[model samples]
Target: MEQARRVEADVDSCDPCLSVSHLSLRFGAGCPSCMAPDAALERNVCPVCGTVHAVRDVSFDVYPGEIVGIVGESGSGKSSLMKCIYFDQDASEGDVRALPFDGGAGNILDLSSQHKRRVRNTVFGMVYQNPYLGLRMDFSSLSNIAEQMIASGERRVDAMCERGYELLGEVNIPARRAKDAPALFSGGMQQRVQIAKALSNNPPILLLDEVTTGLDLSVQASVLDLILRIRRDYGVGMVVVSHDLGVIRMLADRTLVMLDGRVVERGLTDQILEDPQHPYTQQLVYSLI
Candidate 1:
């Protein structure tokens, strides 16, 4: 904790696009993972008092133009980290500091309601496993993007609509369908629209949580390819979360392995795949093969 604070205090030499330090979420008095990592994972409840430690002292960084992937089984706390970072769920403890928003040097985890909205619209773009969470099924695709723009204080109707159209096209949606409701679109198209809207604000940081989980293999490929292109063309930083090893292998430059809410191992994606040091990570990699 002291070392993390030292790095956080200076931050002059370490400019991670997004930095998470000792961030945790607990639903009880004490953290179960801190006591017994294996028991906490095997039975999400603490033996002594049944406290749920959904996430325990998780920490990492996302650098500019980097793709950082978090992979673990369900209930491993990867998704919990996502919700915490995006502020959909608050962390019981720790700080989530971000850049390119609020003068670029404040803990987002501690931001007020107003600042939270500001950060969501301006600093972070999130695509959830369910497109519905990120989109309004009843609204036109263009209007959906425009809503984010308006929230961010972009009032010019003409420019906002134009940018919406451009983003839709960039995400591989037909520009002509901008006026159609997302409900009328196919599942894959809806996800593409969600991606389009996520980028409507041109945020520097993007969070993707199992965005390809339910799609057909081909559809998943298209989405993954689009993500690869977005990174190449825009040089944005991304934190991608998925249980699929293939997906992580395809997208992540670096990978973090989670178990019982703790990050057990992390390193270059290829290295983790070829030579996973942690036993849990080895089992996961072998299962994928």
Candidate 2:
């Protein structure tokens, strides 16, 4: 098996918004054993266990304005890797360094709690598997988006309202319906609303975890188109996690394949899909067709 390797560069001489070196995460056995058997899980065994386990030693880089896809079967560590990068969980070992707006390179793993909060709020945006969960079903769409800004401490009411309406329009939600709650909208509409909220702060990077799941074929196509459009228009780097090769073909510039919690193969989208080097990746590609 290939352990994740580090690509080293001069730390003092690189762009700050994104730079990760020798990053690794391990979740101990007690962590998984503590959860109910029915509790949701992504990787097979605990990453932190001393035994030979899944998702071992993975590492990679994401450049500014680039869209990278992590593709694999269920329980392939795709989501786990994303969670680690997004700060949803802590990596037991390794270094994650990101450039903050203040023009300093800060270690993600060692940041002050206050700085970590700022990094999540101001520099990174995340879109989850379910769009409904991203928004408040009880609040109007406008409120859902406005509240995100408010949480970030952008308190000027007029600016928030204006920006909120603009975001709705940007996502093609008409101003008339902007005040409606997500429950009133279709799945596709709800997904768009989620996108608007994710883009609320214009963060440099977007982490999308199966954002198109459970939608009809037509709706999925539309959502994919919107995602591509957003990437082109905003030039934000994206990390897309999906099991579908078709989705990856349509969206990812590069692809990484994970199996049993470890990355089995990786390459440009065309190369990996057309001429996969790893047996697991080959099986996955065949299964997709």
Candidate 3:
């Protein structure tokens, strides 16, 4: 794998908006045999202890105005890592810090539930792979965005409505459909609504998990375009997780390749696409060709 020389130069000056260090998420207790540094497990599962190490020792930083991509096969811990970051699922152990929260001095993973919620509302905006998980299906699209704004402590209805309409249009959701429930919208529209809701609070960082997985190619393109537009317009740092390298190539400034609960390769997107280090990463890149 040819490592890009430019990555170090590009990140030398700016402080990271989000930093994750030695993050790990596991299910069930681990035995010494499977817990060793040299332990070999079946994929991510401990054969002896029946424990699933969904993510292990993953670390990364997202700088303001940068888009970082995490790519891997299904069950490779990519989505699991995102879930852990957003507190959808608590990580067994890790440290996550955002500059917008506590001057980046506190480990958000260890914060109280109340403080964590505050981080979710004010500092990080999350879009899940499944629209059902990210949006209120029974609520109006406008109401969905307002819900997020309200969580962020916005009390002015007129202000929330203005923001909601602005975001909906930004994501290409028509104002005419603003009052319609997401249950009545198509998958792509629902996803647009979710994106609109995620941006309702003007968060400093966005966590997007497989936002285009099941959409049609054209719809995926539109969603991808919307993401780029959002980044350009809002200048928010983003962590985007996907199984597709093509998507990463289209959007990520930096890319991380994961396999069996660990990051196997990381570099500038072009560097990884041009020269993948790990065998799994090679397979993924070559498949795209």
Candidate 4:
């Protein structure tokens, strides 16, 4: 696979738009046995307390205009980490800070529900693996965009309409088709509409979860191209999650490999592809070959 085009941002000079540290998610109360720093579990589940450690101390940062990728097989907790960052799932333990909020000093996870809602509306835009989770299937594509803008406090109807059309057009949705419901569109079109909605609020950080998972190869290419173009034009930082290393190779500057709820390896995307350190990572790279 061709290496992803490098983002032009001076990453070290710019502060991260999003920072996550020691993020953990568990489905049940944990026992001392499974909660220790040296704890080992049967897969990700605690045999003692039956707690599902969906995510374990995962951490990363996304600089402006940078795309950080998380790649892993099913049950690796990459998706769970994304949900925790976006507030869809409550993290059992972690600190997440959006630089635009409180100068990144406060942990957003501890914020009140009202403030969390504000963060979700203004600081982060999330596109889920399932369009149904990100878009209102019965709402017109334009209306979907409007809904997000409205949540972010856009009150001017005219402005929302203009922004909606502009975003839809940017994602290559025809102006005429913008009025149709997403349920009526193809899978790729629905994803494009979901992306438009995610961008409506112009959040600094975008969380994309398996955005091109089930599309045709040609459509996947189009979606990936559109994502790169958006990053180039808007300079938005992004966290892209996918099981497909090819997609990660095509879009990510840096990559994190997760297995059984923990990050097992991380580095420049090209470096990891060329010389993976972890056995799981080696397996992943070899399978791609």
Highest lDDT against the true fold, candidate:
4
lDDT (tens digit, per residue) of candidate 1 on 1-289:
3433343354335478888998988787765444553453444557677788888889998877788899999999999999999999989988788877754577888889998999999989999999889999999999999999999999999999899989999998888889999999988999899999999888999999999998999999999999999988887889999998899988988899998788999977877888899999999899987
**Candidate 3: what lDDT?**
0.91
Candidate 4 lDDT, tens digit per residue, 50-164?
9999999988888988999999999999999998998888899999989987889999999999999999998888888899999999989988998998887889989999999
Using lDDT, rank the candidates from best to worst: 4, 3, 1, 2
lDDT of 1 at 104: 52
* Model 3 Cα shift for residue 32 (angstroms): 0.7
Q: Which clashing pairs does model 3 show?
A: none
- Cα lDDT of all candidates, in order? 0.87, 0.75, 0.91, 0.92
Cα lDDT tens digits for candidate 2, 20-93: 55454545554554233333344455334333233456766666656778898876767877777777777655
In model 2, the runs with Cα more than 4 Å from the true position are 1-17, 29-54, 100-104
Q: How many clashes (backbone N, Cα, C below 3 Å) per candidate?
A: 0, 4, 0, 0
State every prediction's TM-score relative to the real structure: 0.91, 0.83, 0.96, 0.97
Ranking by TM-score: 4, 3, 1, 2
Candidate 3 residue lDDT tens string, 92-168: 88999999888889899998999999999999999989999999899999999999999989999999999999998
Return the clash pairs for model 2, or none: 4-57, 16-99, 27-48, 55-261
Backbone clash tally for model 4? 0
Model 3 off-target regions past 4 Å?
1-10
Task: Show the colliding residue pairs in model 1.
Answer: none
Model 3 deviation from native, Cα RMSD in Å: 2.0
